[model samples]
Target: MVSSDSQYSYTSSSDTELYSPAADIEHPSYISKILSKTKPDEGKARKSIAETHAEGIENTLTRYESSTHGIGPIESVLDEEKPEQFDVKPDTELNEWDPWHYPVDSETGFRIVQFVDNDRDDPRCWTTRARWNYTILLGLVCFDVAMMSAIITGDMKSPAAHFGVSLEVMCLCVSLMVWGFGLGPLIFAPFSEEFGRNRVYQTTLLVAVCFIIPCGAATNIGMLLAFRFLDGVAFSAPMCLIGGSLSDMWRNEERGSAMAIFSVAPFLGPVMGPIVGSLLSVKCSWRWVYYFMIIFSGCLYGVMFIFLPETHHQTILQRRAKKLRAKGDSSYRAISEIKTRSVKKIAKDTLLRPIILLSELIVFLVTLYMAVIYGLLYMFFFAYPVVYGEGKHWGDIKTSLMFIPLGAGTILGTLAAPFLNKDYVKRAKKYIDRGQIPPAELRLIPMMIGCWFVPIGLFAYAWSSYPHISWAGPAFSGFSCGFGFMMLYNPANNYIVDSYQHYAASGLAAKTFVRSMWGGAVPLFTIQMYHRLGYEWASSLMAFISLACCAIPYLFYIYGARIRERSKYAYSPVQGELKDPEQGIDSSAQDMRSNHQLSERVIDNE
Candidate 1:
């Protein structure tokens, strides 16, 4: 029989021996007292059994890492007396479960871990960063306002009449600019990814200023149209890069508000352009519009060059790594080094992605619907004048002023977006908790509201333009249409972004292509549509089409997530998850390529 107070000893060889205290062992006096009351040596055997269990755990960790890395075998030095204990359950579970590695701060939800200086005087404080970010957004807004002022000049009827050009020819100038704007992104987006955001912005703005100067000096319609198209190309760089720049600075939670403010500029610019252009054209030639834009663009270029630092995390990290390498540091590899693809390959892939996404069934259908909506909205630019001028006897300035209601509606819609987004997020969380699948259709609530109002506004605008009704009816209609427009546009975009997380830029590019084409084509046909059907029937036809398009959002909202789940291109946990905040891209190159292929397959099936 084993003694109760015996300590266990093991021998590996004749020359080597190790001793350890047994788990159930106690002081000799306590063991003797316990033995007096209980069975002798039972505790000694139990303690030996505990020691054996600890030895089993130590062997497991050695095998686990060996299987994972396949690095031959793990040779860990362990003390004979206190051998390392590995929990087999934890090791087995860890091997089975794939770990998600991404740079995410749980407390702040910020992608990058910002090291803050405790000193109040430090420039890297949160307050300073916030202020700088606001300034950048403001600068972008000012740039948008300046560029849009040219649209009013392009939209003017008097200049086309003076030039003895047809309405179609005049509309072509606007169409060309829209075309240039859309096409410019295909080049600029990839270039920005290669070169930095700041470099692209400053260079493009300078090009814009140069082109605007030529537009101001144009003696013929040919010169004016040519310069305007070039200016449009130059201006497109800022539009593409600014959103990415904003993403670099703000976390996902803060991004919605920033996007709201950024979104307003494009809409407001066009609305305000006509107002400013009407007054400027009346007081001075349309030449002053170009001159004013040149001056504004120049000043903005100066300010942006001075203040806008390179905020792109990948570029910043790459530069830091380069500096460290120059100093002969061995540990300064960029996160992007792991994915060693050539720049040419990246460019080729980026260029093809947007085209591939455009071919997707859902993307194509949504884009077509969105394009028609956008075209119909711009068509009103021409239609409003005819209804107000012929029907109500208003001048160009007064006709342009009528767009104020449209701007007002956009403001109201923007204010409501955050509340709507919050509600949807909560609903999504609830669905997850209940083990029920959340559909993407929950995102279309605002879009449904838009569908109801858009047609009503179109009918109201058309019917009320007759001699019997007051002008207030048409104005109210415009306001209603504007509200509907915002509701439809925002949710559609958000849905696409959320669903195609890896291919968002390409998806947006696809949408932009279709939307821009519509914007270009619609105004050209507005005169013909009105002439053939009269104002009431023309707008009513548009309303009918809009009503048909309304079914799209409803279909997607109900079945979108199901479609996404089936889709190879859609966001997924395995391939689509973002890693490395410094690299700052959500989808990997492999995932993006896979998604593009999946999108093609879905399109082909459809």
Candidate 2:
């Protein structure tokens, strides 16, 4: 006899109520019908009752089988429309039978599951060790080469002079390179998302190498500038892709440390470039810089070709799905396969992000604050040489060497950043534990310290470079300014990255575009500014601007969380939730205190 106990019956009427047999509970098809008579909390009660009914049904099935045949039938459920019939077979027979004999499902599944949920903690996702290593290595190489090019191109004044180009024209070449770098992301970001990251990176790096080689052989300033712009375009691919690759490799918590290390290049490149370029320009022609870059780029290209596999999860899964489809299997699908949007729509959205971010009140203000600081810092590169050489009677080499203090300050600041970041988190957690409202504004402490030092250093550097003051005074100011620059940059960037969890790339690109534009433009007019205002008053005016920027960190420190709460783009407690504001000590603050202590100890030892 057919088992009526295991069967579930449904009526044809769509609005009819059905009851679960085990729990004797009824639920209506429409939620409105249930809510009309029941209170809101009663809906939850209905769900609990349905769950109990399911359990009772299961128990009843077990008991019926135990009381009757002592074992269940081996018959399998099959769709009646299908021709194939299930045949009982031995273990060896089943193994020998074609696994493909099973009928395919009518529905096509999605193709982008891997990309959507590639977290390590999730059982459905996993990335290989080799893939992670390759991502990081390729990222390092790509950024190193890109940054090196920016540094060398920016410092190629001697070559421009040799070519009879005015300094203004030469500086324009630098500005063009920066413009190319800024615009490159818009093109590459969407392309990487469309094509696989590895394919895009490999193709672009090769193009960059090709452009770099020709750059060394350029006969005129225009040719050199044209080649450099192309090179910038090629180099930008890696910068845009690396962040996504990092997200593929590491979890949210682990990403900060990785990003911190990756971020070191953009800062260090400028410092390292001038040091190396100064030596190269003095010993050899500026063309040798391009030649050197070509060699480095070529080596990196080979390394990436061998080591970098496609890590973009969608691409990986798509490849897997292709393999499955080739075998006549229909279960394969990618997460992105479900997306119905056209490529044009995706491109349009990607293109508008930087503009949209700039329009945001908070993002715009923060970006402006950071941009001014960055411009001022870069401007000092040009200003210091003129001040120290003409005003203090120092040689070109000696004036360039004065940047060592700035380098020292950057190193000290970078080393201290992790600890400070850790302390801020710890303190936020502490606030949470104590039942206090933890604030995102607590992150502004270092920024406050940094803002104060920025102006102080600018004023000191300006006034101390005169004939009366010793060179040590100006160098000390450089150190202080470098420290302040790091303080301002790190916190602002980290805060933004933390605030916009999914949109971090767009946020970073927005900030990077503004900062690079400022860096590119400021050097061109630095001499004019200094000449018009004289060093003392010119830097003093900059100091006043720095004073205004100090208010940014202060405002955020006070009202940051509230601002985040209202923001749709900003990461809220729901999305990779940040530490509760009140717990113990903010981890970032504690980290800063530790770093401060370490710095003091180092000074003491020195």
Candidate 3:
């Protein structure tokens, strides 16, 4: 008996697991209670594996039915709902269904292996100290991935001079890698879901570490560029998997604090990149930049391989089922094994759905707003050097220190995360009391408040960037920008996940692709933009753009519900009258359930 916490009760572990963050396996008692009400007879229903397993095993059924590639193991509560799909009959010997058959109760016929109450195998049941240890380690990995994006700027001159290329070409090093970050998720997010987080984490990170060696040793620009892109793609697995990994281990109420700690890594890593890169470039050589990444990332990979356990519920159950079968209990099965998907279906979900979701205004504006913010972060790597290094004659090492305030501001945002989450819970209680899900707009309050900080920082940095002014003026301005960056990032990801139910994965993929592409390109033209427009006006240009973006949160906050009501993919409380005849389920009922899950599941990572 899992106690129902109203704060997050909208999702049965089963409903929530359709998206990766929702995939926490709960006790079978809870699942049976919920599923028996929905499908009393159980056996005759032709529901997808997702609906069939929406009881105890979390993603076992949902991930399989939704676009996550396969389901996992659901216990005995629900039998073979879609026997037609499998073409199995009651008397057909168990071997005929071999790898896919549900474990049979000699009398009742169908059973699925499941974790019992307080089962040690469930990640959610792990000790608090263990979970926190993994959380910090995961955050460190995120920092390393983001750091690589900007570290090259520390001594761009050495690389450009050595290779006989221009500074603009060096900018490609950042851009191409960021581009890889975007594209990598399209492949890796699903891969992590299918293969389990630890395997993907170990494999891709090892590849990323290996590729850095080539980057360090490359004689030609071509070799360096090729390997840099590959490293980006490989390192990107963490950014995609860490969010889901955290979800696997933490319950709803406990996740906010962990996420706040996690959120700082992305911004802090980039901020520190120039600082480390510049120090090493001056004391050692530009090649030391790549060497540092190899050493640092290799160490993290070693730690992860030795310490991290498989967090994906489906993979764990699949392995458990395999072991049981090895002992001649052929009836034991994981949901993913019974459910099959075509390559075309998988591609549509991973590739085309994100693009289609962008057509929805919420997805587009939110994505565009994020892209602008991301581009500005990258732009600063160039803009600061122009203001301090070139304009005021400060050396690279000194100029790199200017990023400290930004890092401090991001840490400040992280400190504020718990309070923000607390505030949301307080506000949401009113709706919960009314038996209604809280509006997704509540998530945007932080974004609206945080939005002003970016423009304010930019305006300060712009006016203070004059050569005669104290460096303090331009340098400390980064604090607000960095603060705003962390503050805006987590809520925006929550809003997207809340707005799109089963489709949240694709929605996030869309945002990452667009954001990464724009962030990657910003450095290429930043110097030229500053020179042509003059530092003050160029900074003002971005500040004003950020100022304009402030409307995004308010606009969505006010009219977001209306927009979601009309959207096909975005979760809406107002459901249509349609019903599925074969499954005997009302579309409206499904939407309402999905709506509740959306309001409750706050995904802290994207």
Candidate 4:
């Protein structure tokens, strides 16, 4: 268990203890408790080979029944589809799945799961270009998912008019979608871990495509809102789980650049949505906006079905083990073969973890900070229209063009990723050279330098929107806001991923719940709030909130090791020499790696 106290002691951290962070083979992390939930005394005793085999067979069937592929693994059938999807691959990051592993090796009784040094088929073993293809594909799916959520921006007023309802009633469609997005990941994240990433993506998107057509076809605001909410639920998998997929394909050091590319999607989608919504509303009606979603997503789904392979390590290993079994080899089994846990236990843990995490002051603080930023971003769909269109008396298309500055700022901020990553690697190298445990705080360097600009940009945008100020003034300030958000978020996102490597999926799922909840809820009052407070003060109030949050990353960067020290999951239980904080990462280096292999159990013949 992780200590509640922050004043705990640490062991030595030498290069010789490189694998020290692995947990004890006997006691797994609490998140993993759902899979192998034997009594502690019984768990300490290794299982027999036959017991392992029986457990594997049962668990594999469970995965098969629930897996996204529905049929089975597609490695063999994918050969024909491989040529067009060239450079598709995985990466070499430290795997979070059962890192302290024990695989059944029938020939040698019990052993561990590991990749051969030259295993080209391993996604982690792929070339950089190949890995990027996998990453870019996932990012594209995420970008499109966000686009669907926000494409209603310009079409909002039109939908109300069509339904003969108030604007707030029609805005319920967006809010419901966001609320559905908040609810989605709890179901999807667990499914992906149980099955595979590709499976969740396929199933969710297929359901989403089906749900979207109905929204366009809807006759009443109620029907439209229902479809949009379900569409949001079905489409949110990419938003919540893409970070974990990126982790699967990239090491922590390389994650900054990839996360930077991804971070823009959520922000960009709202701005980009107005472009399509504005155009289609003029010529084709608001329904065409939903129609465009259908066409674009349908094509993307087709590409995905043919191209995306299993990326989760557990599922892929099971596939390999199954193939070996057909050839009369039974030495292979994944670490999850230890035992089968009850559905009750699994459900109890899954539903409660996000709450438990939020209970932690630090986790709550960071997650809240992320939610605030996301909420502000979502509210802009309404706020931007108010500021640029009504205030300036501009037409719909002209108002849509104004959003370009925010996108420009986001793109410019992403361009800073290489430097951020370079800085991370340089510092990481120094820690490695010192034989010190590298802290996840190294990723927050950008946040330390750039968080202040968030408030600054908000303040600038607030005061610049009047007729006296040129539109360029607000536009340039939009760029600053974009830059500031990117700077603040890139590090924040990467830090969470790095901090909760094992629970990354669930961690992010909980995050999305909060983020989307706010994203959905805040927009309801955005236009009203702006009217009540006036744009400058309303925007300045948001700026004040952002200014307060600027302290988060800096606080974590300083005391992060102390914070992680109290987390059972965060700090690897290793025994190594501790370095002073001023010197380097002083890790609790307990060799948490457990390799308890199953032995043969004799059975009496009837």
Each model's lDDT comes to 0.58, 0.57, 0.75, 0.63
Q: Write the per-residue lDDT of candidate 4 for residues 58-158, one digit (tens) a residue.
A: 33332222222111111111223211221101111112232322343343343334332333445655678978887788777877887887788876778
Q: Give the alpha carbon lDDT tens digit for every residue of 446-537 in model 3.
A: 99999999999999999999999999999999999999987798788778877876667677778888998999989889999999999999
**Could you tell me the lDDT of residue 266 within candidate 3?**
77
Give residue 316's error in model 2 in angstroms: 2.2
Better of 1 and 2 by TM-score: 1
Q: Weakest 10 consecutive residues, lDDT, candidate 3?
A: 69-78
For model 2, how does the per-residue alpha-carbon lDDT over 186-227 read when each residue is reduced to its tens digit? 677656545667788789888988988877898888887898
Residue ranges of candidate 1 with Cα displaced over 4 Å:
1-150, 153-155, 337-344, 435-437, 572-606
Model 1 earns a TM-score of 0.72
Error of 1 at 274 (Å): 0.5
Return the top candidate by lDDT. Answer: 3
RMSD of each: 15.6, 15.6, 8.7, 14.7
User: Once superposed on the true structure, which residue ranges of model 4 sit more than 4 Å away at CA?
Assistant: 1-114, 126-130, 251-257, 338-342, 431-435, 497-507, 557-606
Q: Is 1 or 4 the stronger prediction by lDDT? A: 4
